[model samples]
Target: MRTRRLIIGVIIALIVIIGAGFAFGALHKTKTNAKTVTLGIMPGGKQEDAIWKVVKANAKKSYGIDLQFVNFTDGDQPNKALASHDIDLNAFQHYAYLKSWNQSNHGDLVAIGDTIITPIHLYSTQYKSVDALPDGATIAIPNDLTNESRALHVLKNAGLITLNSSQGLQATVKDVKSNPKHLVIKEVDASQGPRTLPSVAAAVINYNFAQSAKIPASDSIFVEPFNADSHQWVNIIVANKKDRNKQIYKDIVSAYNSENVKATIEKEYPDGGEKAAWDLKF
Candidate 1:
């Protein structure tokens, strides 16, 4: 009887331990499954939606991450959303744009992953070519600092204007030391560049905006070079400085930098509008 009692006690203890182990595992699994993240993106056209679906599905299947997207129509909102903790990450702006935003807002957002490079182009509906631009002709550029500087660079490269080299990426219309064409560079909201085309002789437009406006790649008079330096304009997945190294964020980056996503980008924007930043190092 003593031996039987001892056996029963041992069995009861083993059962309790096993039950606790199972419950603990279940709790851990629930915690792991609950992991999710929200990313902000500028609302591109249908292509953007399709690509996001692919990303979302991929992340869900591979990492069990519940990836969510918050779309912003305004170029300025994504970073602001991220800064305010409204979104966990944003995959919209390039390094130059992000840098300018941080400096202006006194924010500490950092890029955790590189995504793509959308070449900025000079598009004109009135003038078929750069040479056709007349003296004192109006040209619209992005109002934001980084893009305004970039637009000036594009204009400088096109020989329509020249900029102070020392100003570099910070160059503005004021840095235009020479405008032989007497071009009137108008600063407008970046999203307004394509819309302003009807009123201006030409406009330096970001690829996404141009695409959104249904502007064709062939309509561009000048396309920014896709080289080493141009990689600085590659769009990135930005996170708050403190969250930069989290494993979930790293997984998100890995998911974005995958071949499936790269292939989708190439397929969606085959006209050189959006080039995947596959070569970019994180």
Candidate 2:
């Protein structure tokens, strides 16, 4: 009977050990098989959307990632969704817009990869060039805070206006100390910038919006120069601050900055409407 009791005890110990090992293996497999990543995007451009379709297919084939997208029409929804963890990532905003969103929402989102610069341009139907506009002519610009300053800076750079130094990146039309042409600065929604053209003497338009409206590159009198002042305009892939260093996130960045993606950008925008910014130091 004593020998039988000792044998029973040994069997019970073995069973418990085996069960523990199997449980750990299951957990490891669960983590290894985790693949689905949902991303949020602002749906505006047909070409841009097609480009993302390519990324989705490549990510699945190359890394076994189940990349999914959540499209948002409103400009403000993506970051809010990301902050709530409703989506794992986003690639719609430039650094300046991201900074503005963070400040307004008190959120801690972070940029994981540099993508491209979809530059702002001053477009006109009536005026041939910057110098061609008559004095006191109406000009349109984006009304949003950061872009208002950016659009104004574009005009300043083109020698149409002089903004006071005090306003920094938050300048408005009121901050224009010198409008040499006495140009009436019209404030409109960023998306509406292109539509105001030919009505106003000119409008400063974002590249994606301009593309959607079928505005030709020849219509632009001034393209934002690729320099230190436009550093914040470089677009980026963003994630929640806590997920900044995740391996999967880094993998996405690598795929986006690949030669294949670079080739696609060059093919799509041969007119130089957008510039690949991953290799750029700034």
Candidate 3:
């Protein structure tokens, strides 16, 4: 009876050990199986919503992984979050802005894929067209360096002002050599440009902001010329330089640039959709 009891004890111990091993194996599997990636977006608007919807759905279906989107209200926030390792990836900034951030901040951010080019437009409530603006009309523009230069370029393009020889792409209000309209250009945050339109004689706004405010691109008094130079304004998918070769990184770009996604963009964006979308060469 003692021997029998000893054998039973041995069996019970083995069972316990085996069960613990299985539980550990299960935990390991769970850790490996939880495949998820997060994407940081600009904000919650129809344009952003449409892009996320197609990209997220395709990412899940094609890669058998989950894609999460976190929304930020302004352009500068995502880069800070990325540098802090708060997110896996972000897709809200144009290449020009991204380059400037990387140069200034010593960030390791890498652009894996180029996304859409959100054209900038000069919208006005007090004027029918850029030509109709009276002399000394006030114009509100984004205060950031990159956008401020672009805004000045738009005004120059409209024959309202000209930049000095020393004034380059980084030019500001001080660079305006000749203001034909005597336009008092006011620099404000890009996100607030939409709301300031009714107050300012005219406001130059990024496409996404205008879309969020329900302002159609066609209604803008002046829109940026769509040319090769404008391609720099295209948004890009960004991740840490270390994650550039990860499978999920490649999958995200694939999902976003797929034929289905292209079709959706074509159908939605006023631009010809995928083929004509002002994105980088795949």
Candidate 4:
């Protein structure tokens, strides 16, 4: 009887240990397989759509991370979504735009990685070159402060007009100190730039919008210089300052700046539309 009782107690002890081991294994698996991360992106170009597909696959294969992309139509929504915690990350807007946004909204967004530099271009259907534009020609520029200043700089660089040096990146048409050709500057919504080309002699259009309108880079009368000096305009991957250093966010940045994605950007945007900012350090 004593032997039988000891055998029964040993069997019960073994069963409990086995059950506990299975429970721990299940819990560990649950912890490892969390929900996919959602990223916000501006909707427009095929390049962005293609890049997101590659990122999703690479993230899953390389780091066991699943990624989902949510497209925001306008410039304002992406930052707003990120700030409200509606999205995990956003890959749009340059450093200047981000700085302006932070200043206006009191937001704490920070760039974790550099993505690309989409050169803002002066496009025209009627004029072939900046010098070809006639006197009193109406030139359309983005109405937004950041892009208006950038357009003015491009005009100044192209020798079409001059801006007040002190006005800097905050420059508007009012800041234009001189117009050599007496060029009539029209401030329109950035999206309207390409559309206004038929009405105006020329328009300064952001690259993404130009690409969306199927405007060839060769058609640009003037293109912004892609160099260290223009680094402020390089688009970036952004997150809330508090979450900037998270390991998962770093993994996403790594996937974006991966060699494969870089290759894709090189092949797709070979023209002056958008160049990958691979050399930029975060």
Candidate 5:
């Protein structure tokens, strides 16, 4: 009985020491210094780079926190890097895209605050106006669910097509209840839509894809309207769920939504006087 009791006490002491060591190490690491935050963005384009410049400058001014900007060449790359901890946050996607990614990937990425929506645009190679297109005109739209529906919505709003009332934002060609123009709609990958423009009558392209392909926003035939209802679809700064409320997160959002940032976005992705890339709702 005495031997068993002594062994049990030793084991208990050993476990306590191990637990205390882990606690101390964690505390020490956390206290070492303010962490540098890395922000992931889409590869440098005139519009996005201009906006990030404002954000980086503001973050430095507001919190004395260093914002390191990393660039990804595609839509999915930022999220992938964030999941791997190669980046601490990202600011290139909107809530709709972010939500779809989270649902499909079964990941816990969350938007910390809203940015702006780079408006989906319909650009044409053969015509300057939506009504001038001839019958059987070939129009291109993003093949993915999120952007495909947004393109279809633009068509519906233009009175070129009618979608089933129940179809909502996920509507596809099959959901088109009316196609008065007999438009031949082709679904291409989002990034490829702009390149397809020279071949098709028009292509409904995402803003990032358009910018990357050097398609000017001022040259597009149509753009999505910026309104409060579109706020959820506007671009956002996102972070892992664990880091949503950290000081760095607030600083990032603050930097992106500042007046300086707003003016830059306007010059970058403007429609009328509004910055179509972000709603400025935050």
Candidate 6:
């Protein structure tokens, strides 16, 4: 009986020592020291980088989190890295994209917080507007499962196509109920949408790709509108399911949504290109 009580006392002491940082840092809602977290993101966006500049700096100052970043060139890599514990967090994909990824991989990743949504828009070089496109004209859109669905929904909202009502967020060309002009949609990699603009009548381009191609907002023919139902499009901070409730992740979210970070986002996309998702109600 004495040995068992001694073992129990030792376990309690160990718990206290392990939890000491959390107890002392409870006021800040983060560990009191410089705990490192590896974040994965796709490189090359000015706005995202600017926002993160603020997030990274402030995370260290306010929460003692040393935010390190790993830039992934491939669109499919960030989540894969997060799943394998190669990364602590990722801030590239939206909720719908994450959901599809989870379903396809049978993985258990969860969004810890909302980030920003850099919306996709239709851009054209030959045509001035969606109404000006010639009949049976070719349109280019993202070929991936999540973005293809999103691009189709954008076209449907622009009155160029009618999608099957039951298709929900993953609509495809086959789900188009009507295509009155017989327009041909060329499915290309998401990054190639802007490059296809000079050839196709119009291309549905993700905001990041358009920015990368230096296509200004004025060059777009149609912009996708946001609504209460557009929650799926909002970008998110993601982590392994086991880490979803970690206080450090919560601190990171708070850091990202701080006033300074939000102001940086507003300054970067002042023309309404990409807005912070903190205040957006789903």
Clashing pairs in 2: none
Model 6 TM-score (2 dp): 0.79
TM-score of each: 0.79, 0.81, 0.71, 0.84, 0.74, 0.79
Write the residue-wise lDDT of candidate 3 on 184-228 in tens digits. Answer: 899999999989998888999877678668875555888777654
Candidate 4, 42: how far from true, in Å? 2.9
Worst 10 residues of 5 by lDDT: 273-282
Q: Write the per-residue lDDT of candidate 5 for residues 150-174, one digit (tens) a residue.
A: 8888887767889898865667789
> Which segments of model 2 are wrong by more than 4 Å?
1-31
Sequence-dependent TM-score of model 2: 0.81
Which is superior by TM-score, 2 or 6?
Answer: 2
Query: Which residue pairs clash in candidate 3?
Result: 266-273
Point to the candidate with the largest TM-score.
Answer: 4
Model 3: per-residue Cα lDDT at residue 257:
79
Question: Candidate 3 — worst ten consecutive residues by lDDT sum?
Answer: 273-282
- 195-216 per-residue lDDT for model 2 (tens digits): 7896999999888789879999
* Ten-residue stretch with the least lDDT total in model 2: 44-53
Sorted by TM-score, highest first, which candidate order results? 4, 2, 6, 1, 5, 3
**lDDT: the better of candidates 2 and 4:** 2
**Candidate 5 structure, TM-score to reference:** 0.74
Candidate 6 per-residue lDDT over residues 58-146, each given as its tens digit:
98999888999999999889999999999999998888989988998998999999988777899888878889988999999999987
What RMSD value applies to candidate 5? 9.9
In order, candidate lDDTs are 0.86, 0.87, 0.80, 0.85, 0.79, 0.87
